[model samples]
Structure formats: C-alpha cells, structure tokens
Target: MRLRLLLCVLCWLGTTPALAAENSRVLTTIKPLQQIAAAVMKDIDTPALLMEPGASPHSYALRPSDRRALAEAERIYWIGPELELFLQDLLERQDSAVDLLHLPQMAVRKQQQAHNFQKDEHASHAHGHEHDHGSLDAHIWLSPDNAKVVARYMAEDLASVYPQHVDQLQANLAVFERSLTALDDRLQVRLSPLRDKPYFVFHDGYGYFEDHYGVKPQGIFSLSHEVQPGARHVNQLRQQLQAAGPSCVFTEPQFTPRLVNSLTQGLPVTVGVLDPLGSAIDVGPKGYEHMLEDMSGALADCLEAL
Candidate 1:
C-alpha cells in the first residue's frame, strides 16, 4: 500500500507542468509586451492584453473592461509612462505593475529635435495634460535587440512569480533568443538593399528600428504619435516633403492618412502603410518578429518602387 501511494504521488507531481501557474493572471498594457510576455510564459501562462488591437496607446481611453482587468490582474507589464501617457498615474496605484522601460541594459534613444519639430502636440492638446517625454523616445521595442532584452527581463520576473515553472520559463527564453537571432539575420539580409533610401514617416516612432538597421527616414510629419500637424507645421512638412522628392512616405494604421496624402500629392513620392505598433498582429510568440518583418517589407516594397 505504501509503495502504490508513492507511485501515485510521483505521477501527480509530474503532471503539474500542465496545470496553470500560480498567480499567472499577468496583464500587459500593449500588444508587443503581451506578446513578449506570452513567449516567455509559454506552456505556463498567457498574459491578458489590455490595449485592444488598432488602439493607440498614446491616446487610448481606458474602458470599463480595462479597468476591471487592471483590478483583477495579479501582475502587470508596461513600457512606462512616457509612451503610454494615459497609464501614468493609474500604474502608480498598482503595486503589481512592472515598468520594463527601466529594466537593466535598456538602450533608450533620446528624441532628436528637428528644427521643424518645434511644437509638441501633447503640450497643446484638447485634454489638459502636459506630457513631456523628457526628450526620451519611448519606442524602444522597435529594436530587435531590445525585444530580446524585454524577454529576458520578463522571464526573470515570471520565474519569481511561478517558481514551479522556472525551468520551462528559462527554456522558453532560450528558444526566444535563438529565434530572435534567426529573425535578425533574415531582416538584415532583406533590408540591406535599401540602405540610404530616403523615406518619410507620419509619426516619428520608428527611430529605434531605423537606428538599429541603419534605414533612417528622411523627414517626419509629426513629432507626437497621436496628433495631426497644424497648418504651420503642415506647411513646413510640405516644404520638407517637396525637398525629399522621389521617396516613400509611410502612414500608420492607427492614424488617418489624410494629412500624409495631402502633403505627398503632386510630389514624386509613394505612400506606404507602416504599422509601427503592430496593431493588426495577433498576440503570440512571433508577434515581435512579425512586426519587424512587416515594417521592413513595407519599407523595401515602397522604396523599391521609387
């Protein structure tokens, strides 16, 4: 009887990997972070995503459902207040939240001021909030290397929460790292042909990717992610667009293309869509890689046409 009981106990222990992790109700503010966390927590848990697809984090108003999710979440992961300005004070109230922006070894790109980028739309918004990024560009996840760092940091965090799944989490992170290397090599080979090919972006959110891959844009229409350029700024952008002739102009899915189209009309420019936030991408292990691949494809396709 004792021997039979010992065998049953061992079988139950072995089956624990298939069970839900302890305190696994993880929540992430954006799709990319959710994707990263999902990859790290593979086989153990799937983090609940807060921001809906096609929603702009910069301008997203929290719904009742989102508020409920926040209330119930055991742990939360987000970039920081700089990118998701809407989540600043709310996150301060959540003790379980982890701000990945301040993670060790993060390479934050400071916002480079264009003489044309004088007006910050957030400073003069309809909402009476003044959001100064402290000149920090919060689009850090666009860098593939940054994605790896995020996964590493995320794995470390998850390991603490679910110590029972530590081995699986570490294994998931290793798989993520190896897969990232393969994706980086492929992106380099694919985007290598379009080096120095000038392009224009509707929003200045691709600085991290551009800097990482050496495919910088020629000019930007707006400095803020969620605002349209004013008439004065539009005029300046038009002059700049006219100067950057025979190039490609990229528009984002989250914002309207009306301004971009108007500026590029009658100019030797091809308009292309670049989804910086990967709003259309489904949350999964390959979400980050797919976002970079999609952006690189859009760039190469548009630039090659010009």
Candidate 2:
C-alpha cells in the first residue's frame, strides 16, 4: 500500500506544471478588456495585454514583440476592425482572434458626430495621422452593462480552452456579476445628483458612460483623437461653452491637446482629466471597478466645483 501511494503522488506532481502552462495562454487587446478578462480568470490564470498603458489604440503601430505575442497567444480578444484599425488585417488572418464588438450579446452604440463640427480637411497634413470613425463606438467597456456581457463571453471562451478550469471560471463570472451589480447601484446613487450638469469631453468616446449614467455633455471638441481640432472647431466649442454658461471641459490622459486650455481660456469652465484606459490604475481583478470609480470622481469633482 505504501508503494502504491508513493507512485500516485509522483504522477500528480508531474502533470501540475502542464496544467498551469495551458491556463496562461489568454491575451487581450487593451487594458479595459484585460481588466474584464483578469476578473473572469481570477486565481486561475492572468491574461496578457497587447497595448501598453499609455499607448493610444487610435494610432498604434504593432511592435515586433507584439507580433510575437500574437503568434504565441492561444486566444486573442479585441474590439474589432473599428477601434484597432492597425490590427484588423493581421487579426483577420488569425483563427484564434475573437472580436468582442461582433459578439451578439454586446450592446453597441453609434458614434455621435460633433455638432456643428466640420471635419478637419487639412488634419492629415498637419497631424500626419489618419482617422477612421466607425459607425459604432468601440469604447463599449465604459458601460458596466457591457462589461457584464464581456465577462460572460470571456468566461465561456476560456472554459472552452481549458475545460478543467470551467468550474472556477463560472464561479469567477458569478462573483464578477455580483460585484458589478453592487458597483452599479453605488454609482447610480453617486451620479444621480450630477445628471443635469452639462460638460464637454475632449473626445466623443464617453457616450456609453454618459448615456448609461444619464450624465449629459453639452458637446464634444473633436470626434477623433488622432485628428487635432481645427481652428473652426475650437471656435465652435468656445461658442457652445459661452452659450451653455459655466461648465466643465474634460480632457483624456492619452490626448490632452494644448487647444483645450486655449478654448476654455477666459471662460467659466474648469478642466478635468478622464482616463478611459485606466492607465494609472493597477491591472487586476478589481481594476475595472476602480477605473469607473475614478472616472465618476473626476466628473463629480469638476462639475460639482462649479
């Protein structure tokens, strides 16, 4: 009986590393997606992020290391051809690539055009970057409802890859849903008072959050981050701010153009920073909640100050 027990223990130790190796093959395109993937994979395995914290998905050029990571990844999650145009061609060829935007469960919103905002026809000459605004906004992760959908799909996808961890993944998904529900309840209470507060975002990317929380923005300075706001657009935003009265103008961490200061100058507007990518927040199971909380705080701080 002692010899039989010793043989069984040795066999179990031999296969443990193989199981761990299988579980660590997941990859996500951005920090927000990584946050959801990490939550679904809590304690089982951590997914790798394709884009670095400060990198702009609007105009990212894939590095050689990124290519290698893509080649080695067992499964890749991205928003699709709209947001990450750079990866569209390459991902199209990869069978393991999964476009989250294309998922039927995801609730998508159309990108809103800037009001009285004309396209910067000479933007390419000045900025040297092209902008392609897809009909749908790819920043769906901003909405907590969308995050729940993403987490469910991630759990399902990971379960298929590592069936041995299916039970754990399902438990993680349950925890995520519960936590999201609690967070949403708390946020609704906190943001309820600020619903009528009018503000302006530098980019039109926060429509999902604004719509979900009933936070209204007077207007957007630019539709695309890659394209700098032209003189005409800046003047138009200034006019809106003047007409709308004292309001806040929020800029993103990734692209706080110098024009923001110029546009808000001599006006009763305060500048606030909103980071959609959660660049400053640590990446982990609770990162997504932290990101949303930070955004809400940023909005409340500036809008309430007025």
State the lDDT of candidate 1 residue by residue for 1-306, as single tens digits.
999999999988854422322224888888888878878988897887777667777678986657767777788888998778788998878898888878778988776544344554531331112334457777788888899999988888777789899999999999989998998898888788788888877555787898888887776554333455566766667687787778888877654566556566788888888887788887788777787788788889988877
Q: What is the per-residue lDDT of model 2 for residues 141-241, given as tens digits with 9 covering 90 to 100?
A: 99999999999998898887889999999999999899989999998998889888888876667889999999978776653344556777567668888
Worst 10 residues of 1 by lDDT: 122-131
Q: Which is the leading candidate under lDDT?
A: 2
Question: How close to the true structure is residue 28 of candidate 2, measured as C-alpha lDDT?
Answer: 85
In terms of lDDT, the poorest run of 10 residues in model 2 is 122-131
Candidate-wise lDDT, in order? 0.75, 0.81
lDDT of 1 at 303: 84
TM-score of each: 0.83, 0.85
The segments of candidate 1 whose C-alpha lies over 4 angstroms from its true place after superposition are 1-24, 117-134, 223-233
